[model samples]
Target: MVRANRRLLRARYGRYEGGPDPLAAPVDLTEALDAIGEDVMAGSSPERAMREFLRRGGSDRAGLDDLARRVAERRRDLTRKHNLDGTLQQVKELLEKAVLAERKQLARDTEMDDGDRMLAEMQLDALPASPAAAVSELGAYDWKSSEARADFEKIKDLLGREMLDQRFAGMKDALENATDEDRAAITEMMTDLNALLDAHTRGEDTPEQFDEFMRKHGDYFPDNPTTIDELLDSLARRAAAAQRMRNSMSQEQRDELDALAQQAFGSPELMQSLSQLDGTLRALRPGENWGGSEQMDGEQGLGLGDGTGVFQDIAELDALSDQLSQSYEGSRMDDLDLDALSRQLGDEAAVDARTLQQLEKALRDSGTLKRGSDGQLKLTPKAMRQLGKALLRDVASRMSGRQGNRDLRQAGAAGERSGATREWAFGDTEAWDVTRTITNALTRTAGEGGDTTAGIRIEIGDVEVQETEARTQACVALLVDTSFSMAMDGRWVPMKRTALALHSLITSRFRGDDLQLIAFGRHAEVMDIEQLTGLDAQYDKGTNLHHALLLANRHFRKHPNAQPVLLVVTDGEPTSHLEASGDVFFSYPPHPVTVAVAVRELDNSMRLGAQTTFFRLGEDPGLARFIDSMAKRVGGTVVAPELDDLGAAVVSSYLSSRRSGGSGGAGEDFDGMFGRGWGRWG
Candidate 1:
């Protein structure tokens, strides 16, 4: 019963007998959908896959839509099959909330941690007391809340202190007579002494009585000490003891201490105190001394007069404000009001509101955008992909058309069968004559259905077959003009699109053919078909057709019998080349040298049994004259096709050449290039 059903299916849908099985053969859609689904699951979208499909000459929208639907369905089915839907959704939501919480906590932690750590440490040291009293005892100032007048008075009192002048005088004398090594040693001692004094004033000293002694006599210290090494040794001992005390605290204990200290002294008053101390320390330098007979004006002399001091005081405030603004900017993802964007793009535009909305949702879902406190929009990698997809769609749409005369083939070799029968081979396709084999066996068995005899003959007539020889061979080189002039006429993009389409055609349709891409501006370089989509014309000196043709010839040299052909797409004539002295020579108005060089390259190509075709953009009479001359000289063809006809022209030219036994025949007919009986509207 199964065998009968199988025969019936074969009779209904199978291919021709002794030929390829049409139903069993792989369809392009199955392959494309497989690839598209792979990309989609790897975080691509239907629109993106569709755009890529179109760019690769899968230009039928209905067909692509079907493939997209299949891909989506496949993705959904796979998600269900692997039991990943609910798990993925849960994971996504959990990760999203966790990430958002993390970001918020990080910002709060960072802002609260800066400069507050010092005040917090101070508060911790002075525990078991009110924070305000501890801060006052530590000389903490509230610069923001204090009257400007009070700050000015404090600045005056600090500048007029007698200790600063004495220190300056001692430092000036020490520096004037010291040798380099003595100066270096004294400088090192002063640095250590200053650090020690700072640590003592900050109440961070160990062996508590020594800290008190330093606080009392720190004013007697010199800027540069004669006993430099001794001072450093003393400071190092103190620092080591302090470090040991710090290391004795456990992680949890340290964290608790830090948190408690933060709660106590993380206030405006503590910050002002640190700022005032920093200012006073800065004033201790030699040039900054204001305690002399000068009796400096408190406001003008210290660059702290009138509003200047206020500006200095508020510098950090301004920085904080700026940081807030940047944070708002970075976190805001709602800035692009989708409703407004949809309206702005308009319903009739290439990208509709729904498409934009889908893109925005994709971005949001992908975590590429987040909403800020101010309700502004922030862009993420997801948003970037959306934008990229939109751009790619626009570009691919602009370049869509029925292109090239050659029938685009798949990437692998297609089999062709000969009429003559051969002995059945091991690798032959299974579509061969099974009925003939069984009939021959039956006749040898004298028409018996259950013959078990040993003398059953296997004849040549019952043998199955497959191809044994190479049926098709072709080698093509695509030369693109990447000169600045191509961009001048807005022709570079179209040229790139044409190259991409041709590449897609040859690679996808005629995979057995050898294809090489070479780009030329001021120079020529070999490129790949895959690289054409991203090709941009170079801003160089001038077009050099001679160099490009010579390079193309060299590329095709190894493939001597594969029907070698060159397709040159350029907007201008040759204008540059290397001279005998190896210096670049450029000329306009058809220099004889340049013309001779171009002709010589073409001559060499022809000599090696290769054909060259030129596709010119824009109608320059001079370029036309040169092209006509070249075409006649090489017996090739020149096409000055309009944009719409470009695809047909290319396809027609290639197919015509292919059918003409691989020779450069002029003006071969290509009226049916698109397909047999395919009509062109207007």
Candidate 2:
């Protein structure tokens, strides 16, 4: 039986090195735009609103605040969980083992002279209690046991590796059990490095010199720096972190390490070289935070080099925290350092920040936002249409759910085209009767018998437009309460959203309808869709329904030939009314005069034969009673929808009123609406 041997396959997993993770989900621009629109409608500037959305992030992506919080946590963990005494502890252990081995060897040697053995024991016992002193005193002592002598020499090797590692990262592991030749090579490299730094400081160093230096000692630096500035940046950051670690150490620890550091490689040469390098780095890169310190009070011990690395990490975290705050002048999403963030917090964080950057850029470049003539960021007309559509969709969804899947968008009559054509006049938007127009042009050209080579000269008189039988149109007045109570009770945004939804519907679908947005805060004013959507929350304490009703009546009077429809949305009774002198009279409790004035206006609207609807918000007993009474008096419908359903309720009521005939109008068939301010845009 021939059996084949099986081979095992393995896979390695590391950090993804591509520009961005393909697996990372893209930012939802719609969700972001909706959030920004809400804030914009709530009185925030477009730029401020966009910034807030990015800072808050979305349901699936981490935001700036979350990343900043994580950075703080990571920094706290670094400082709270470590102390800098690894090398000192290691040196003390080696010293103890060496002394014990020497004592055991002395006791085992039977042929040694009594006086010589006593002398050796006295010298060992007489050594200072300090690890550094003990190691230094043992330098001249002769040892009989190879094990004891090796342990004694190991202390020197440990100090040498640590000292080198402190100056140049990775030296500790790379120079394990280093030979004299290796030490000589390090010393040579340090000399050359110091010479290069001195020349650079004097402004005499050339790029060639920098290239030569790297070529000679490039392996010492793991970060492959191509320019002198890059090299300095790398070295300065590490060197500054090392200084901070020293500053953080207690005075006693500093003294112990100082003594121990001098004995590195059984000499003081390495420490001297390192001290010179630190000085040069600090001098050349004075912007480094060389005086900073941290308190490390935990159980885990870190050597000098590792402590420096942690300090560097803390510095990077600080930078990320600042970048995420975005509170500084000229601060922007692109200011965030993704590379440093990834190194400190992981690739996921970098991806999140990058996504936010892309989102902000897209919003700005998508023509959704623009800078006004005043140099302030504002939403563009396109943004208004987009926001309106989103709100309309939301309203439709709620209406569908509430009304059992009924179509929310009721189609308005666009009228049938009359089988006759007339000459097109300026400002006429009616579709051109193409066949009639061509026939007119052909007849005119034939009658004139003009040049036959060139294209037929069709004058303005030859253009004939097709006329349509006028459809009955409705004049809608959406009176929304913008009083302080609305803002306090969280009805401000909902009311604005309702207005925008209805406006969008009338302007986009029912182009023949005239919709007026009247907001009654301390006073009533006629607002366009853009004005109402971006209206700031009012703190004035008055719901001027009387003034709003007056405006509605005037709007109905203006469109005398169209059907009148009045919709009033309010959360309170009439607390204020407009006096004959045009002054506002406001009171907390329902003023009798104010209620009388509002009632009189409602009666006037009823006489005008407007189809009316009262959308009462909140559960205040007085408000419900007042709204029911008003609706009953005018024979109008009353709807009490939740705040979330306000938009749907208003939009549905508008559509319902259009379907039902008004109390009075010119006729069922509208006339002269084709070229007479039909669409909102016109």
Best by TM-score: 2
Task: Kindly list the per-residue Cα lDDT of model 1 for residues 1-682, writing each as its tens digit.
Answer: 9999999878755324543234442223423333333233233454354334332323322232332343344333322333112211232343334334433443455456656645544443453343223223334422222232233233222222211221232332233333546534544444544555466456564554344444544443533333333333333322322222223334543343233222211233322332333343443322321221111112221111111222222222233233222234342222223333223233232122223223334444555445656664343334333433433333333332334322222111123544433445322332455656666666756755555465666665555443222245668887888888876666665565565556555554456678888888777778764344335446776777777887778877878768777788887888886566756677765478987888898898877766667887787888888887887787777888776555445554655565454533623433332323334321
Cα error of candidate 2 at position 437, Å = 35
Q: Please list the C-alpha lDDT of all candidates, in the order they appear.
A: 0.46, 0.83
Off by over 4 Å in 2: 1-26, 402-404, 410-471, 588-591, 663-682
lDDT of 2 by residue, 256-343 (tens): 8888887788868778888999999988889999999999998999987777788889999998899999999888899999999989
What TM-score, to 2 decimals, does candidate 2 have?
A: 0.84
Q: How accurate is candidate 2 locally (lDDT)?
A: 0.83
RMSD of each: 25.5, 11.3
Q: Which stretches of candidate 1 lie over 4 Å from their true place?
A: 1-470, 530-532, 580-583, 663-669, 672-682
Task: Report how far residue 606 has shifted in candidate 1, in Å.
Answer: 0.9
